[model samples]
Target: MKKILHAGNNLKGKQANPTYISFLGPKLEAVGFTLYYTSQKQNKVLRLIDMLLSVYKYRAKVDLVLIDTYSTSNFYYAFLVAELCNLLKTPYITILHGGNLPKRLDKSTWKSKRLFKHSKLNIAPSKYIMHEFKKRAYSNIKFIPNALNIEKYEVTERGCERLKLLWVRSLTPIYNPDMALEVVRLLQNEGLDVSLTMVGPDPHNKFEELKETINNKKLRIEYKGKLKQEEWYKLSENHNIFINTSNFDNMPITLIEAMALGLPLVSTNVGGIPYLIEDGKEGLLCNKDDALTMVNCIKKIHKNPDLRQSLIVNARSKAESFSWQNVKALWISALA
Candidate 1:
């Protein structure tokens, strides 16, 4: 069995949602690969130190180091870790993430090149990221869609008697949680009976602003801060629609989970979302921050039963292609 050191935010119980490492580590282990993970430390500085130390400690023991590369300040963590791997003559792979990463490549060209070009492989979860890297002439990149256990997600029939909108993501500025509230407000203003439930942690304290807006506007919005996967899956049974209002995103696992649960999707067509859901096919997409368009998309789904059924069937089909059974071979081949 190959020994792999996976480095990323393994913050499953740390008041944050499970990231890629948290999900992928166990899957790899179950498939006969020995996996080690690093840096569940919440503090940024301490986390960086821990990640660096883990790389140094496991440098000789592990066959490969899997770095979860992102576009934010955490990008620096990936850069430093990859450089450490390079200096220690250890093979490493970068699992690319975040929709803003293409911008990061342009903004930090030299750093991006050093970090990605020297890696053993660059794994892109979406074609958007793959295309962006290929555009810059990077040949070490490969497309591997993110995986989930499709059997765990139970699909339920959606009754269109009332609109129950579900939004699942961190309450961050980039995700634009406020847009969800606005979409709900617009639907209600147009004399539609709609209620929204937002599930996510407020890492940046944006929930305070959202709470104020919900109170002031008197919208029927329920803010359930940071639920476990199963908890939210149960909550999803009450919801008929899943809305993603992120201003920027990669291929979000939540959207795929929503598809598996048979919730018709209405998302902003930003970043890699278009690559995930074709407009009017698997789901409906609108411009970023355009609450009105999202409202219209919801209205379209609610009014048209055939369209809703088509979206649910098509989306669930697309999501099944991302199951772990199908995707594990890609990982096994890439790792080999």
Candidate 2:
């Protein structure tokens, strides 16, 4: 049996760690491949040493290595992973998950261009990301949409009294949690009995700032810090509107989960949002950083029953195309 090393840092006992790293393990193992994953901290000083140690440890066993892309185009890890793979004479693939990499590259003073130049293969989750990399004429790139299995959400109304808006992302700067806070404030200011549940753990770095934003704005937000994926999905079913405040995102699983739950979507038009949404169709996209526009989009769905019903129908249908069974075939083809 062929052995593969899953080279990515992990957060101790965190879902995102196992969840993201376990992607290729099952599928590859089904085909008689042995997958070994070792999680390491992302600290630069120690990270390089840990990676070299991993390469040395796995050198004699694994046939191939798949490196997880560091979040938001941190160029540092990408370079290290690629260069390490080269030094060890091992073949590797880098899955680029940062949807806002294009913006960072455009604004970056760092040497992303130079570091990524030696990358073997770049696996992008959406065309939006691929488009950004392709614009720079990067080769050896493939578009692999986020693999999602269709979820079963029992359609039922949780109470029609107050409009429930759900935000299921980390309270991080990249996600622009303040936009969510501001939108909720706008809803309450308009005398709307809207309730918001912000689900997801603090990325540690931005939790304090996020709390300050909520306290400063005096918004009506319930910080339900980090929910299990299943719980969050179940919660999404009870919610009416799903909002994504990410200023930089490719295809977010949150939006897909919302669609599967038959909840209408109102997201900012940034990163690869356009790839997942057909404005006024499956979902609505607002100009990035425009809390008023985001609020207006949600209010539009809240007020018009027919519009909400149509969008729910359309969004659910669009989401079907991204099911794990369906998307895996695309990934297989890309690997071919």
Candidate 3:
């Protein structure tokens, strides 16, 4: 039996998507891999003593280590794990999860430079990101999207009449939830029969105020904060149209979730979004911050039955490629 240490954050208390950590860790274990977990929050200065102590504690039995990578503060986390891996002489894989990094492992800092330059493998979830890695001239790169069990996957499709537009994202500034709200306002001013549902927990404390502002402006919208994935899954069943208003993103798991559930998307064309959805094909694409374009797409999809069905059918087909059974194999191969 092989042993693996999975180092990452425990987001249960912080209201984060722990899907990548907990779910993928256990699934890897079921395939005869013994797993261990260590939660290291993003951007915390690494206490060299503690990390060295951890290596001494677990080094004897751990055969391999897996570290989840990110572009922001979490990038530091992977570097720390990579250092520990070096000291222990354990083969480690860094699963890069950001949209910004080029596929190459080379970097200016010793941490990234060493990890990219020396790690046994580097796994990116999207080709959009993998190509970024390729620029670094690293040959160990592979693509493996996050894991979602397709057998248990069920999509909820709301009626077009409901016309409930949804944006499932934190109200953090980077996601630009305001753009979705602006679209809501634009459609309302045009007297469109629409209601926007802004789900998920807000990090910036702006959602209630955004909700109030929408009401003051007489826009039709409902702000439901922080829904559990399961609860949101049920809510999504009644939602026929999905919208993503992200400034920059790697492949979004939520968009894929919506696609699998048969939602026709009206998304801003940005980052990995274009890779997942094609204009007038799998889903509709609008320029980022162009509220009226989103408004037009909403009206277009709502009115045309065949067009809506075409998008839904194609979106679901695109989603089949992201199934956990398919994605996990990539991870297993990279690990091997």
The C-alpha RMSD of each candidate to the native structure, in angstroms, is 0.9, 2.8, 2.7
lDDT of 2 by residue, 1-336 (tens): 667777766545443423456555677566566787755665555765676678778988877677777445345666676677778787777777777677666765355664455655778888888888889877778887776667554444544457898988877677888788889888888999887888886756565676786778776677777787778877776678889999788787778878877888899988788988989998888998999999899888888888888888998887788777777665555544
- In angstroms, the error of model 1 at 91 is 0.6
lDDT of 3 by residue, 237-263 (tens): 766788988877788888888888888
Per-candidate local distance difference test:
0.93, 0.75, 0.76
Q: What RMSD does model 1 have?
A: 0.9
Question: How much does candidate 3 score in TM-score?
Answer: 0.90
For model 1, residues 183-230, the per-residue Cα lDDT tens digits are 988998998999999998888778787789899999999888889899
TM-score of 2: 0.88
**Candidate 1, residue 137: lDDT:** 90
Sorting all predicted structures by TM-score, with the top scorer first, yields 1, 3, 2
Least accurate stretch of 10 residues (summed lDDT) in model 2?
10-19
**What's model 1's lDDT at 291?**
91
TM-score of each: 0.98, 0.88, 0.90
